[model samples]
Each structure stands twice: as structure tokens, then as C-alpha cells.
Target: MVGARTLAHLAATAFLTVAGVVATPTTTHADESSDPDAVSAALWLATEVDDNGGIPGMVGTPDWGLTIDALIALEATGADAETAQEITAALKSHVRDYNSYDAWGVPGQRIAGATAKLLYAAVITDSDAEAFGSYDLRQETLDLVAGPELGLEEGRVKDKVDAPSVDSSNTFGQSLAVLGLSRSGGVPQSIVDFLIDQQCSVGGFRLYPYAFGGGTVTGDCDEQGADAVLDPDSTSMAVQALYAAAEHDSAGALEAADKGAAWLASIQREDGSFGGSGPTEASNTNSTGLAGQALRAAGETAAADRAAAWVLDHQLTSANAAAASAELGAIAYNGESLAAAQTDGIALFQRDQWRRATPQALLALADVSLGEIGLVDVDPGPVDPQPTPSTPGPGAGGPNGQLPATGAPVLPLAALGIGAAGAGLILLRLSRKESTS
Candidate 1:
């Protein structure tokens, strides 16, 4: 009889081929062990903040979504004080009036789900942790979890905006709320309890109690909608938020994390990459990154490494004429093609006195590799020494919880996918609709 893992591999292979995304061998034959170097590199890169103290989004812009994710990544990397302080400065600048109602707590751009993402950043960042813990953000925060009565199906925060009603329609928003409030030092246990009650059996989370039938999601593209179902991306983020809450308090949080981790592992491609479910499924770097993080947290280091390595390789090479002609120097996400020039530019970037990508890759690689060092027990030789970038990608949050949004204040959330920590990426309204990978 095929093992569960083997069965999952077969299913994933079928899924990928049917979905039309390439599942290359490099992405498949993953290095199964903890990548201490990768983790260190990614984490170290987190500390190399921009002048504004924020990680650069794909377009080299500062955005709150990246800010929150960057902070989370910084926390994971274990950055030092100087680095942490930069993160704090950025957070302090943007979080002053972090009303959940606004996009990045600002008006104009009503992003798909900025409310909870920014709030989560504020709750976790070093500067406003105390305020996050103590402030009566109930009116703003509670609306996502439940009605004041604390029910899952109905929420207190109703989006006044006509197009996207907030109340219960926004599960992503609600998940962020649960994570932010739970991680916030000051939030009451009642809030955590409310979110927990909504967990689904598949180890995934639902937007709201009634929004999805099982509290989690399943099925193909048609049924799930654009953001309808729970893929590794949303599931990992939701579980990470839950894990953060569990770490602070709650014995069951670990158990929930374990289940989520298992579910994520079960979905790993034969080569070790994880793809979001459905007819439109494509492997996502952000999802892979988060899944690797969740698995690492669950003590599945070998499995985590496999996923991490795949993510690293997915970084756009910027090679090839077609790729060279296209936008260059940006991180290749979702299997983006690089222009030959862009690829060359990245190569040049790599050759610089400070090699940015190499180190960033190393941090996550280290975390996964180190965690699995005992599992693999083989030394790959001396790692290439690379200087950190002048401005690192997201993941700049420090231990004290100080993480600034990318250096620019009030930038659009569309730049980076999301911040490093567990905050989801912002899906900018890009004209080109790439596959989810």
C-alpha cells in the first residue's frame, strides 16, 4: 500500500500537470534537512533595512503589507538591537492611528485585507506592543473576531464600504484580527477563544463561521473563488497566527499547528514544493515560505528544508532573452519570467561587494537546514560569504517587536506579497494575472 506521503505525491503530480505549471526536478529533489545557513541569511537580510527602515517590495516600494511580514520575518531571524530599532522606527511611524477600519489604517486604497494585516504588525512590532496590549482597540479589533457577543458567524466590524461588506464576508480580515489580537500582549483570552472555535477539521481556517461550511476550505477553483478556499498560503498564515497565540497562551495552539503542518506536508509536491489547491493551482513562493516556517515551528525540519530549498530556486533568475526584456532586478515570485537584462542585472547584483539574494536565501536555508542538521548529518562545505543588501527584502522586525513598514510612509500595500512574519502578502492589482505559484 502506498504511504500517505506517496499518495500525496501522486496526487500533487497529477494536480500540477493538469494545472499546467512546470514541476522541475530541481524543485522536486529537495535537500531534506534543516538549512541553518538559509535561515540565517534570510534573517540577516531582514536586518538590512532601507533608509526608511522597511524591506523593499517587488517594485522596490515601501508598503505596510511588506512591513508587517518583514517584522514577522525579522522576529524569526533573531536580528540584533540596531536592526530591531530600525524596524521599531518604521512601525512607530505608521501605527500611531492604526484603526482596523482603514487600509494600512489609511483611506483611498481599500485593499483586499489590509485591516488585519496592519493591525497584526502593530500588535507584534516592538514599539507599539504595549499599546497593542493595553489599548481598547475592541471597537476596531473585535469586529473581525465576532459580534460583541463573540459569535463566529457574525462580526462586529461592518465595512461601511458598499462593494466589500466587512461583517462576516471577509475571512482573511477576520483571520488577521484573530492573529493580531491574540499576539497582542493586551488582548483578552476571550478573543483567542472566539477564533479557535472557528477552526476547521482539514487544519485550515475559514474567513467566518458561516462563510465556508467546514471552518476550513477544500475543492477546486470554481468552488473556492479567487480567495475562496483555504490553500497552503491562507492556511499557513492562519495557523501561524494561531501558533503565535498558542505560544503566548493556549495549550491547544501547538496541536492546531501540528495539524496544519501535517496538512501542509501532505500537500508537498514530490520535489517538496507545495501548491495551493484547485484547477487554477500554482506553487506560490509566499505560501512555500510560510509553510516552511510553519513546518519548522512544528519540528519538521527535514520537511521544512525541502520546501525552503524549492522556494529559493524559484527566485527569478532574470535569464533568457524574453526574461531579459521584461522587468528586471525584482524578486521573481509566482514563477515570474525575468528579462535577459533583468537576469543580468540580478547577476550583477549578486556580484556586488554585498551579495543580497545569496544571503537572504541563506537565512531561510540555514533555519531549515539547522533545524534538520540532525536529520541529514552531512556538511555541504563552507558557505559562500556574502554581504547583506543595503536594503533587505521584508523580514526586518526586531526582537523588541520594532518593525517599520518599508521606509516610505503610507505606501501602497501592493508592493510586496506580504510582510515576513506571517502576515499575508498584498495582491496588487497587476494587469498581468500570473499563476498562484
Candidate 2:
């Protein structure tokens, strides 16, 4: 007769115990003098950006979404003004009519998630969201939510512009829409309600409401089916949105955020990592970063610290520099994929995965919470005339600027022994791995 939440927490504890993960101190006390991981990761991201200021994708093309993620990381880590200026200028050049596309020449309707991410970045960087590169990012994001074709009946944000028939947008997009809209000005009550309704009874969130079989009814969340897989990534993002909205006096926002944070804490592996319920079922940096930030935003400091420690332990630091070579500071998606990429010379699939993982991991290392990033008040002003070195002061790391090792034990994913879910969950494939918020 155990409740679902209790069952989940018990399962997590059992998984951790079986995996031999020894819990570390959840309290983090590092300062600028002691922590260089954040700065090093920021510098690594700066190097990844091309001359044009966009982060290179798997195919070596400019990806605005990835660039935005990197920018957020840079801001979180307090990167040099010149570095921020160069990247923001580059991001500004790519602004389109209504939204910023993921990459140029990709021919598809504007992605609501991408637009929402850009708006959030703009606000944090103090750029004019209402007038960035001749486009009003704030207005455009609002339009995407208000448009009859893109917005669902009860204020849900649709995934794509062309797919008018599909009413329910993915939870990632919905969470971003809520965060962006709330930060830009004020989020509508209906929009907030729609996102809240997406939470499942188990306290987790499904990536999408509609069943994946393609014959399900439009805009439904009451019934659970094959498509209703509880995803850690979506749940984390939803927690972030609810926390941000709660700051604006939104009713039930804080309560919902607490529920989502509890779910994340309950599901965390002994190694302090998280995995999605779909394609990304293995513990990886991307899910950990998202969940960590959400936990911090919700004031779940113990869970947040554990998640951050896991990310730091897995990063390519001086301890692992010999193994990583030139890839130092780049956070791998997972140890298995990193090994494969090292043996196979960075395949196309691994390119975007690393690109997305590094910045997210950096955010955790920097101890930057989602609520803090959204509330950045720095005005986007002229770039600093002089650029400073990426290296931190003495007591920080060594010449290569590697982070000081925390001596935390590295745990493998296999130890958990929580094999993938049934085919019904795996076959849905609705949740594809992508760059994060």
C-alpha cells in the first residue's frame, strides 16, 4: 500500500545501494578562489564558437540553439564582457522575422522551444528582447503562444508552426514557454494552468500528452497510456517554469514546483545522475544538469548538490585530461559515448551531444540555478574594451585551468541495473535528445 512517490524514492534508494554509491557532503563551499570548473567550462564553450559566434553543430554548421545554451552558461559563470559581447553580437545577427531558427537553411517552421530559449537568454543578458536585431523576441514569443495554429485550446504551446493538427506540445517546449513568458513580462493564467495540468499523478511529467500511435484524441492528459512516460528532463524543466512563475505571484506555482522537485529527488540514481524515460534512458550529463538546476531553484539544496557533484565528477578535468586530450573541459554526454567517440573520432551523433552537454554541466558546476539565470539584471551594454584571461586566480587550479578534483568516487551507470522500460515506452520515441535550456 505504499504511495507512488514513496515507491519511487524507495526504488531510487535501492538502486543507489545496489550500485555502491557512497553519498558525499551535499553542502558546497567553493568560491571563485577554489572553483575553476565553471570558468574552464565557459572558456571551452568560447572556443567551440566559430568566428561568426555560433556554436558548431554535428555537421559543423552554426546552431543558434546551442549558441544560446552556451551564452547562458557564460553568463552564469561570469565570463568576460568581451566574450559575452562577441557571442551576443553573433546571436543578434541570426535573429529572423518572428523567431530564430535552429540553423540556417534547415527549412522548417519556427520551433517554439528555440524561440523561448532565445527570449530567456536575451532577458538574462540584458539585451533588448523587444528589439533584438530588428526583431522583437518578446513579441514574437508571445505571438507563438497566441497564434491560433500554434497555441492549443487551453494555452498549451504547440511544438511546430506547420503542425496545426497536433495540439499538445512537448513538455520541454511548454516549460520553456512558461519560463520565457513569465520572465519577459507576465505569464497568462491559462498558460500557467496548462503547464501545471501536464504534471502526472506520480509527480513526474510526460513529454507529451497525446499517445504516440497517432490516433489519440487531441489535448488530453487525464488518461495514461503508452505515451505517458514519466521523463526526468521534462520534469526538471517544468520545475524550473513553476519556480519562475511562482516568483510572479502565480497561484499553485510554488506547490507544483515542490512536487516536481520531490519527484526528481526520488528518481535520482545513487550516483547522483538522472535519465529520461525514453530514448535517453541512460544516466547522462544533460538530464543531470537540468535536474540539478531545477532542484537548486526549488531550494532542494541537498539533491542539487548531489546532482552537481555527479556532473563535476564526470567532467573532463585535469584528472581525466590525459584520457580526453584536446577535449578537456568538454563534458561528455556519458562515459560510454565518450569512449565510443574517442575510439571513432567524434561521430556526427556525438558532436551535438557533447555540444549540448558541456554548457549544461557548466551551469551545475557554477552552481547557477534556473531561477537565478532567469533573473539576471545585467543590462546588455557595450562590450568591455579589454578581454581578460580565462584562468582564475591562485588556489584555483593549475596552468591548464583544470578544476581541483573533489575526490568523489565515480560510479558507472550499469551498477544501477534498472534496465530499460518495456517496448511500449521505448518504442514511443517521442522524446529525442536535444540541446537544453
TM-score of each: 0.57, 0.73
What's the lDDT for residue 379 in model 1?
32
The TM-score, computed over Cα atoms with residue i paired to residue i, of candidate 2 is 0.73
Instruction: Give the per-residue lDDT digits (tens) of candidate 1, residues 284-345.
Output: 44445556766765667788778666655543322322333232222333333222223454
The residue pairs in collision within model 2 are none
lDDT of 2 by residue, 1-437 (tens): 01222233333442211121112112122233213666666777787788877776534656555677788777776665577778788767776421322233323445455566667767667688787776677776666654334344456654343322222335666677776666666676667777777777678877665655452434545565446668787788788777766655556777777898888999988877776654467677777887887777666778878877777755555444454556666766666545554456445555656666787766556555565563443332333322222221111111111111111001121012111110011111111233342
Global lDDT of each model? 0.40, 0.57
RMSD after Cα superposition, model 1: 13.3
Candidate 2's C-alpha runs over 4 A off are 1-35, 97-109, 146-152, 163-168, 213-220, 225-227, 340-349, 374-434
The numbered model that scores best in lDDT is 2
Residues forming the 10-long window of minimal summed lDDT in candidate 2 = 401-410
